[model samples]
Target: MAQAMLLSLRRISRSFGGIQALDNVSLDIAKGDVIGLVGDNGAGKSTLIKVLAGAHDPTSGDVILEGRPQKLSPPAEAQRLGIETVYQDLSLIGTFTAAENFFLGREIAIGRGPALLRWIRRKSMGDTAMRGLEELNIDIPGIRSKPVDRMSGGQRQLVAIARGAFWGHKLLLLDEPTAALGVRESREVLDLIKRLGAQGLTIVMVTHNLDHLWQVCNRVVVMRRGRKAADLASSATNMEDVVAYITGAKEPMTPRPATTEAGA
Candidate 1:
């Protein structure tokens, strides 16, 4: 038998007064599947992700998680429901050490009452943070004590990912993870995303780079002008099709002039 769907956006809609950010958008995500959302600048890709990440509530419609209907009113609600999002900006405290950032806002308490304020459990937090990185197959040059400001862009991305994965989240939303990374760093980040998917976490990445989408996603959903244009299996379709969908060219032709950008 087939497995049950992990997340579903049922007729989801969001608007900004005169502008409809998303219009009756519906999507179903399965467990362990990597789906890429593609669109133009105003195509509502970010808005859709924000809704899924609990950054915005739908103007109308429901976001159902794990077969149960829910109203995701706040980002905290989604986080509590095992949904984690690592945005491009990735809100990390650069001044904090790796371990400090890892355990930020979630310090290990020593007791259940007022006596619990024993201070930050330094040793335990560092060890646990290191192990989490190891589990994600990340190699840290320094110990967890290294400040995030000292780490590379790729390392910072890894830290964001490690934070989400450590809690065994059910769904992870990635917004342009590889946008500014160099060749090797981009590859590393993509590999990590795949590893997370292999470990059974659903991933929904929003990117215009069809090459990255082709490399990391199993399915691709195209969004155009605040609406879904098409949803196709990556293997069954090529870059030409995606470009065609994005540009509204709908040209009856081959070799989309913008096809070469796929390997990046």
Candidate 2:
């Protein structure tokens, strides 16, 4: 049976001055989907992600989330709606511990007669962070106290993802999650992503690494020149076919063995 639809992009389009970054692209993301967004530079992958993250508004189109239309702008609105984005930069404070970074903006406070007089709950935050990581089966030693800068690249990425997973209840968007990690670290990060999916966290990932995408994503969405070129089931298509779509060597057609009720 097909999964229930989580989000629908209705003829989404975006333009930068005269340049069209996205042209009437429509997509449906189902619950528990791990969609891999792939394309070359200038393919509008980043712009599309920003649109979903509420960082950029479509020039014309609608975003429907769980059957209700939304105007996702200025980012905070998206966060409130349970959509979290982890960008390529990771956005962790190098000097702060993992627990601190996990609750950077949304910290727990106690005895708050006034906002300024309230005290932050350090131990509670650390214990909660540790529990969340353990639930994801992520074994990062000293994650509660170690500074993100002191950890390895892969561990840092995992920490950022864990933070997103903790807060984002509906959707998690990741941009080039394993971009600069070593082989071992990349493997660890991929394993964590798989674990998140197994726990029913819907995810959309943007990455240049096709191998990594195949490992974690159940579906692939290919973009070319600011438009969706192809959307296919990862198990039904090969890397060569996906590359062909990305390079414009193959035209967009109805995907075989459609993975979603909306049909690719």
- lDDT score at residue 9, model 2, on the 0-100 scale: 86
> Residue by residue across 1-264, what tens digits does model 1's lDDT show?
165678878777899998999887777787888999998999999999999888998999887787789876598888878888888965679888877777776766565556445666788988998888898889977646678889899888888877877753788888898887888888999999889888888899998678989888998888888777777779999999888988887632232212212211
Count clashing residue pairs per candidate.
Answer: 1, 0
- Point out where model 2 deviates above 4 Å: 111-115, 254-264
In model 2, what is the error at residue 50, expressed in angstroms? Answer: 0.6
Query: Residue pairs in steric clash, candidate 2?
Result: none
Give the poorly placed runs of model 1, Cα more than 4 Å off: 112-118, 251-264
Please, what is the whole-model Cα lDDT of each candidate in the order they appear?
0.81, 0.90
Residues 1-264, candidate 2: write the lDDT tens digits: 456789988888999999999988888898999999999999999999999999999999899898889898879999999999998884799989999999998888887577788789999999999998888888888877788889988889999999999999899999999998989999999999999998899999999999999999999999999888898889999999999999989997653323334353
lDDT of residue 201 for candidate 1: 81
The deviation in Å at residue 222 for candidate 2 is 0.2
Candidate 2 achieves a global lDDT of 0.90
lDDT of candidate 1 vs native? Answer: 0.81
